[model samples]
Structure formats: structure tokens, C-alpha cells
Target: MCIRVGEIENMINQMRKSLISIAEETGLNSDDTICYSKKLDELITRYQRLKMNNKQKINQKLKIVTG
Candidate 1:
């Protein structure tokens, strides 16, 4: 299944909330909190990369059509 930008955004939001809750409950240095933080970082990075790629694709298409 293709994951759209909105789905990734929702996942990012959920991950942020989960990370915050875990840190608050277990302390910032706890292993679980650190793990969630790392996962959140990964999700955010993925989102950024996907958005950049989409923008580049759109630019390429526009150039092909109008250049």
C-alpha cells in the first residue's frame, strides 16, 4: 500500500505524543523513552525525506511540461 503524506503526518503526530508520554512517565533517560525518541526521530526524518522527494518530482514534472 502506498502511504500518503497525510498518513505519515498522522504517524509523526502520534509518535510525538507517545514519546512525550513515555518520557514523562519513565523519565527522559529511561531506555523505553530513549527508544521511542529514536523511533520518533526516524519517523520525522522519513517524513522530511518524503516531502523533499515529492517536491522534487513535482518540479521535474513542471519543467518537463513548461520548459
Candidate 2:
């Protein structure tokens, strides 16, 4: 479980870094680049929230089983 959480964190970080790099390459001052960055951030946040909710559900199930 710890390893999986760590992996997810790393994946999210990598995705954010990649998006930032792409934005930089495209020139952040441009409206398109800014829009892309904001979209990416929103998507990532949504994904992470979904992941956390799923993890919590699984943990709740595990607790029921173990307790």
C-alpha cells in the first residue's frame, strides 16, 4: 500500500513536471500555453482526487475485514 501510494505520488509529480516543461517550451506568456497549463493542472487535480477517493474506499473495506 505504501509503495503504491508512493508510485502514484511520483507519477503525479512527473506529469506536472512534464506539463510545465511543455508550457515553457511553448512560451508561458502566450494565451494558448497558459490555457494548456491550466487545463493540465485541472485534469491532474481531478485525477488525484479520484485516486484518493478510491484509495479511501479500499482502505475502508480493508478495515472492515481486519477489524
Q: In lDDT terms, which candidate is top?
A: 1
The number of clashing residue pairs in each candidate reads 0, 0
Pick out the ten consecutive residues of candidate 1 with the lowest summed lDDT.
Answer: 1-10
Candidate 2: pairs in clash? none
List TM-scores for all candidates, in order.
Answer: 0.94, 0.61
* lDDT (C-alpha) at residue 42 in model 1: 91
TM-score of 1: 0.94
lDDT of each: 0.93, 0.73
- lDDT string for model 2 (1-67, tens) is 2335456567667767877787778776877667667766776676677688888999999999998
